[model samples]
Target chain A: MVLDFYFDFASGYSYFAARRIEWLAAAHGAKVRWHPVLLPALTQVTGVLPSPVVPVKWAYVTRDMQRTAQEEAIPFNPSPAFPQMLIAPGRAMLWVRANHGEEVAVSFARTCFQAYYADAVDIADKAVLLGIAEGLGIDGSAFLAGMEDPAIKSQFKEGNERALAQGVFGVPFVIAEGEPFWGYDRFGNLERWLAAARKVA
Target chain B: MVLDFYFDFASGYSYFAARRIEWLAAAHGAKVRWHPVLLPALTQVTGVLPSPVVPVKWAYVTRDMQRTAQEEAIPFNPSPAFPQMLIAPGRAMLWVRANHGEEVAVSFARTCFQAYYADAVDIADKAVLLGIAEGLGIDGSAFLAGMEDPAIKSQFKEGNERALAQGVFGVPFVIAEGEPFWGYDRFGNLERWLAAARKVA
Candidate 1:
């Protein structure tokens, strides 16, 4: 079966989930599909301030991300330009997916997350998005225009809508078969659930 | 090291943590100190609605708790009368602690959590709180009075303030030495952190 990983470039937990999902999917013999969703839209629908805007949750997540990262030995430094949408990077990845295919699209997604989280770069900036695209050998000036392409923008919107329709209300949401699991913390629960099916098979 | 468990009787995840922590602590050769905190008060200070009031979270939490509970095989049937505080029960436990001892207080807290989550009882009810007290061999008539005792009320308030001072903004918040961990999901992390210290010692 396939595991659908719905993530946002702005989410620190999603960064970790991306770093971890490859191995976990490999272990279970499942293909991973990365779908980027806009976190603000989901949070707006939930009628609560997004975690970063809420003082308590911001304080908790900043520390939680660092603590969990340190424990897992993952390279982490939350972006100085955090809480900003990576819409430009998101659209760029969508264009890459359409032309280059899933492997490169997934690579673009991972690099965007690494840029924002690991390298503390502004993934939302047009130059930074172009830099990431060129790093993946996608030509720069054309890729810059493609990030604003109407077709790719619609595709990004569609991905977010589809993720919401699949019952994803937060970042780092994963679906194995059709069962949805939210949070990096629930990764173990997700693995165990998958294992039960494996044992039965 | 002492693991301070900050919990509320209203929380289903706290119920699971209460069940799981004992063995985790025993395995690590650490002591657990249970601290009851008023969830609403903590949430109020956070300037956000509690999970039960947020539709997305309320939906996720209900499903997440059930999914987690089923995987772990814990006895759970979230209180039909959930989203209600167990204030009387909280005070009663404080009274039990003052009168009986920590052992009895811990037992009282566990029973209240079980009564709320497993049995679907309204733990906020005075008679229910009294029944729970008497079930544990405490005198029902005197215990009912003790639940509202001025000293017990103030002690409960003091306990909540102390939890806030320690940066507890959510249920199942635990502190191992000076490091704080939140949520039932973080139990493994807490255990791993404790294990590191154990090895060094």
Candidate 2:
């Protein structure tokens, strides 16, 4: 079985979901396909306002993420400089996926999430992107070149379009067999769903 | 303990939450206080866009409600003519709470949810409000008068303000001990929170 995990570097829920999805997939004998897209760009396309769209929701999300992270012991530290222009990490992550295979891509994505969320690093910086690539044993120059690849750049745009077409209004959106589930909160449903599908399979 | 259940007539998740909240509350030895606020008005105040604000969400919400309703065996039928102007019912419900107590208010709210989401009834209409009141053995004339009460009208506005003050961005929003949980999906968290609080109490 396969679960298509669509995420964005700018989404806190996506950070939580990305951290947890692999284990969840493994438990249900399912493999996750990581699809990174720019949340701001996609939401703009879908007429869904970007996060911090509302002051109340912004306040609520901060509290909610803290509460859930505490409950699950997920070591969440929201970036002091959040809502980072995450297009860099988003494009780089997908570029890694195309070149380095899913495992390495996932590893690179995890570092970006950790840097932005856990360590408050500015992942949008090209220097930071190169640093993360070097830390992951990928040649810094090659990774930087990959980040600038015209095909990878266009792939990011097409990826956003494809995700919007998939009815992905929110981050940490997961799809399996055309069934969409949104949010890290929906992980319970997704797990149960994967378990059920495994049974049928 | 008390659970503040903020709901709007137009929210399908509110219908699902309203149906199940009492049972869940009973299990945790808590009482639910029903607060009816206009979802559209409140979301606007918070800058949280209304349902159908985006084409993708409108489509997703339709399928989501149906899938969830089926999974839970809740009878579900969306209003053919939705986005009903619900000021009449909202006012009537608060008035019922003031005069008739929480139980009557809850019963009225449940009927409104059912009418709009289960039976495709135009619950926003004054005639429909009177009919629901009459069916519940309240004086139809008195109910209509209460819906028009100046005090009730002010209360409705104040209620929306209060809900927003407490950071309500959406319906089926439940708050306990200063912590807010949104959506029918958050019921699991609500139950766990309540149960944990019970132990500490």
* Most DockQ-accurate candidate: 2
DockQ of each: 0.51, 0.54
The count of residue-pair clashes in candidate 2 stands at 0
Q: Model 1, residue A190: what's the lDDT?
A: 84
lDDT by residue (tens digit), candidate 1, B37-88: 8888887666656787777678888888999889889998766789776677
Number of colliding residue pairs in model 1: 0
Candidate 2 structure quality by residue, lDDT tens digits, B1-201: 889999887777888999999999999998888888889877776555676666677787777788788778999876776855567878889888888887888888888888888898888677888888888888877888888899999999999999988888789899998889999988987888998999998
Tens digit of per-residue lDDT, candidate 1, span A1-201 = 799998888788899999989889889888898888888767665665677766766787788888899988999876788876667777887899988899999999988888888888888788888888899899888888787789988998988888777777888999888777899998998889888878888
Q: Is the docking of candidate 2 incorrect, acceptable, medium or high quality?
A: medium
Off by over 4 Å in 2: none
List CA RMSD, all candidates: 2.2, 2.2
Whole-model Cα lDDT of every candidate shown, in order: 0.84, 0.83
